[model samples]
Target: MDSGELEHPPAEELQVGPILLALADDNRRRVVAELYERSDGERLCASFDLPVSKSSRTRHWRVLREAGLVHQRSIGNGLYMRLRKDDLESRFPGLIQAVVGAP
Candidate 1:
């Protein structure tokens, strides 16, 4: 331990690799796409029709949230998801477009 110094938690760091990894999954891609296309810019987790199971979706959401690619809010038994477009774009310009934009 260094004298007269404060140790910061590792969780404070936001790594880009996890964000890229979250986008690497096809199902996560779909979820991000839906959230991107939503007129309201938010959606209930139940509203998604992903091919993966609910548990799988939960995992995907966790990855996305952890990567700072998505923001999640819980409401009773469900989750509300919103794309972190501004944050993402601010971090890496045109990244979301390059991934989420392509057909």
Candidate 2:
């Protein structure tokens, strides 16, 4: 990994199959939306007052990260997440926007 790039589970190494399975839910979508609202350089911590079990919330986040939809960084005991906007946009143009704009 580059010095500036924090060590992360390689998006390539992650099991995309499991990630896809986990993301096929409404709750996961909400989690993504919540993260999307944050400004660049900001991260969404798991403990940020969501109405869900901690275990379930963790699973949701793992799905996003493993699927290459988001990037996760470990800071102390907390895991912070940010959407992989540019990467995903390049892979699937307008996919992020379509999902975010979905009602």
Candidate 3:
């Protein structure tokens, strides 16, 4: 959601270093790839079936959010996440396609 409760960097403030660092992890990359593949391009955080523990999953979400690769909002007890596609595209054209290796 646009008005997210969680703290994350603004799209304009997104940096290559943090985004690359966050994407370096396979699990985090998987999350990005999955998000990119979806037409709607949004999903609940719990909807992802990552191999890591719940705590680790939480950490991954933080990394992605902090990197400005994703936006997250709390809905009741669950968190909803979506790729910052338009923002990313505006800030760094072709970056997502190059990183995600999407066709």
TM-score of each candidate? 0.80, 0.71, 0.91
lDDT of 2 by residue, 1-103 (tens): 6543444455445554554564567787666666667778247465566678888777667666667777877676766778776666665567656676788
| Model 1 Cα lDDT, one tens digit per residue, 1-103 | 4653323213345567887888888888888888888777788888888888878877787788878877777676767888877777777788887898877
What is candidate 2's TM-score against the reference?
0.71
lDDT of 3 by residue, 1-103 (tens): 3554788788889998999999999999999999998898899999999989999999999999999999888889889999999999999999988988943
- Put the candidates in lDDT order, highest first: 3, 1, 2
Worst 10 residues of 1 by lDDT: 3-12
Taking all chains together, the TM-score of candidate 1 against the true structure is 0.80
Any runs in candidate 2 off by more than 4 Å, and if so which?
A: 1-23
Residue 11, candidate 2: alpha-carbon lDDT: 41
Best by TM-score: 3
Alpha carbon lDDT of residue 57, candidate 2? 78
lDDT of 2: 0.65
lDDT for each candidate structure:
0.76, 0.65, 0.91
**Which regions of candidate 3 deviate over 4 angstroms?**
1-4
